[model samples]
Target: MEETYLSAYVFKYGLEKALKKTGNIEEVTSRMIRDVSGGVRVEDDISPEGLIWIDGDNFNTWLKPKIGQCQADGSFKTVYQAAEHVAPDPYSIYPSSGKCTADGLVGADGKVRKNVI
Candidate 1:
């Protein structure tokens, strides 16, 4: 797998509140669902950091009460939540040498590549 990078943001309030204010949850949800299947690819060396939103269907519902500020009364202070099924980042899950992207994978030599998945 290739080494991908995604910048995460942490706000004073919980993820739910922050998303509601910024109105970025919808965009995130759409990208996660359509591109990464509601999850981000990771490996032993690579790990997702920060609060990830799970059970996010156009902000219809959130899986865990504490997403970002995982404290008392919806305080997402904790970075990681066990029950959250949300993805950390955007589309990723392809061989590093293939140069995979949102559209598909690309071979290093630029040949013999057509990812079905």
Candidate 2:
């Protein structure tokens, strides 16, 4: 089965809340992973693949909302590390910020119109 992962930030709040309510962090995290993965799509910004195109600005604005964190510093630490933590998976927690070293999509003309980075 393909592995899946989520941004720690995205699951942090929900995990904390579930822990408070049920005192079961592992179960909560498992359920969250399942819920997030279900019905996911490529166009969805949080999808694992889509994350590749996410820039620091977009990560702070979009991904942070689902996780309830404030905008990250320009250094891009939070998002990049989070993505790396969950690798080889079709999960959304991956980093998409411009600071990442991965290459992005190219246009039909063979020019790399990849994400900023």
Using lDDT as the measure, the top candidate is 1
C-alpha local distance difference test of each model: 0.39, 0.36
Tens digits of per-residue lDDT for model 1, 1-117: 112242122121234444554578755453333433222222224334433332222222122333464567863476755665433222235455465344444567776467545
Sequence-dependent TM-score of model 1? 0.23
Can you give the lDDT of residue 38 in candidate 1? 26
How would you encode candidate 2's per-residue C-alpha lDDT over 24-111 as one tens digit per residue?
6555666654333322222344454343222222222223122323455632223333333222221234333212222333344555
RMSD of each: 14.5, 15.4
Q: What's the residue-level lDDT of 90 in candidate 2?
A: 19
Mark the regions of model 2 whose C-alpha exceeds 4 Å error after superposition.
1-6, 26-29, 32-117
* Cα misplacement distance, residue 74 of candidate 2 (Å): 12
